[model samples]
Target: MVFFNKVGKVALGSRLRLMTAIITDDAAKVYELYEADFMPKWFPVFYTLTEEREITITEIANEIGHSQPSVSKIVQEMITAGLVNDNLKTTDKRRNIVALTEKGLILSKKIKLQCIDVEAAVESLISESNHNLWAALEEWEFLLEQKSLFKRVNEQKKMRESQDVQIIEYTPEYQEAFKALNEEWISTYFEMEEADYKALDNPKEYILDKGGKILVALYKNEPVGVCALIKMNDENYDFEMAKMAVSPKAQGKSIGWLLGEAIVKNAKELGASKLYLESNTILKPAINLYHKLGFEKVSGLATPYKRCNIQMELIIK
Candidate 1:
């Protein structure tokens, strides 16, 4: 939900965003996908087949963006394989009329079914992503595509254009932005009462005294998001999990997930077996994210607190 640097220069950390795709022609599974959908359900790319008219081999190659020789070879292979018919009367007899055989039509239908399977595979990988994540990916991809294709931007040039986000130990240097974003977030979205906002700003020092790690997300030189990790030492309290809060300005752009990912990755680096989080059910989007990241439910595990209304945990390997 970032809207900060519009028409202005931004920092490095603000520029790096991640996109995920399940269907990549570059992967080995591409063959699997191809096998799934090689047959045409009205093959939009092939005009003659759709119109039941004759078209030259060159026309198909141009439509599919393949070389003429390669298209001819594939057509020849399909004819021999009985998946297509290429022998037909044309305005010119030497030129063949191309159409799918009965076998090819059946295979095309089968492929359409397998494309459904490909979609299932994609859904499984990310679990169930939120609408926000999917929508953000779509918008971001279009922006990046415009820059890469039309702007003729190179990889290194794009890197230089990206923001410089740093994930480090949280210190007093970040308290201002942290406090500012949190207060603004409460005021803007949650309509949080004065008591709730005050309580958040005045979190107990004892909680911070433990193994709390602060992660500050900066766009170029400005602070955009902040996450805190409070380690539970058995001396004070036994069970523990990570804690995070992001700014309203940075709400919908997956900054929270960025912060969450950094915290989880660090948890693995620190060798924590199970990472827990405490949040109110009122924050439905955040809760849904925990589910997407493989976190399940537990009762009464939340501690060090008064702010949380619900509890969730993730077991990290």
Candidate 2:
């Protein structure tokens, strides 16, 4: 027997390939010993054609779970060996049909008897095992048909991540996250200015002490996003929604939208009349989200950061 030293410990795919090769080799030997006129590989196409009588190459490929090209190649070989006939359909000249010849029919009779013995041998081997490998294989195939292995794994990963995400009011513990999340994006796109650092580094002094509120998004209890609503004026209840950030890994799960919505809801509770924000035009997706959340473009707004070229405001009605 051919063997690799670590083959037994390999993954399922490698083990299945090895098993298929071993079984095909053994079946070829058995066919030779019985003096069968056909190879083991030809058995599937031959047996299917015999049962199907007259069928297209495409039909045989579908029935046997093989590519049409592969079945067509095998059919050509069978035609050359005088074991099968390939003819163009009179009604549909474009379609080619395959049928077993007299010699193939005789071989099919012999193979049918041999197949019974092979089935008994396979049953005996399975009966000796503690677990039913055949039933497990069928179950696995059914599950895979329902959804591909790749899609199932990806959906599972998304579900686990979604379960861990939670949005909450900011606390002292999230002070570093408030700074780090904002700094990460600002440093990547534009230089971090003094105003950015002041607001990020000292949220309590610059924001909370000024009657503003901050919100943080947590993934598995770890802060990944932050957004702040700064009080602009007390008389008209005006506020500036600024200093929003989400980590690179936590960007695509609508975390920013959730943070924005949470802050807007808080603004309503605080009796704010207008919510304003300063941002650059380069941030297309962020701007798009702002537009979606009822924020519209407005000119002539003073900004502390140099990156602020576009200003938007939402009238909280």
Clashes of each: 10, 0
Estimate candidate 1's RMSD in Å: 17.7
* Per-residue lDDT over 1-317 for candidate 1, one digit per residue giving the tens place of the 0 to 100 score: 25545634343334443111322323335435566434332234333454444567777877766788877877776677676787676678777668877776676665556557766776775576555555677897788776854354344443453335555666666766666776675555455555444334644453356545667776556678776666765442333444356655555456666677887887778677777777777778878878877778777553544556787777786
**Model 1: how far is 151 from its true place, Å?**
22
Error of 1 at 303 (Å): 4.9
Question: What's the distance in Å from true for residue 238, model 1?
Answer: 6.9
lDDT of 2 at 230: 93
Candidate topping TM-score: 2
**lDDT (0-100) at residue 209 of candidate 2?**
94
Pairs of residues at least 3 apart in sequence or in different chains that clash in candidate 1: 1-252, 1-253, 11-163, 11-220, 12-163, 12-164, 13-163, 13-164, 13-165, 15-163
Worst 10 residues of 1 by lDDT: 17-26
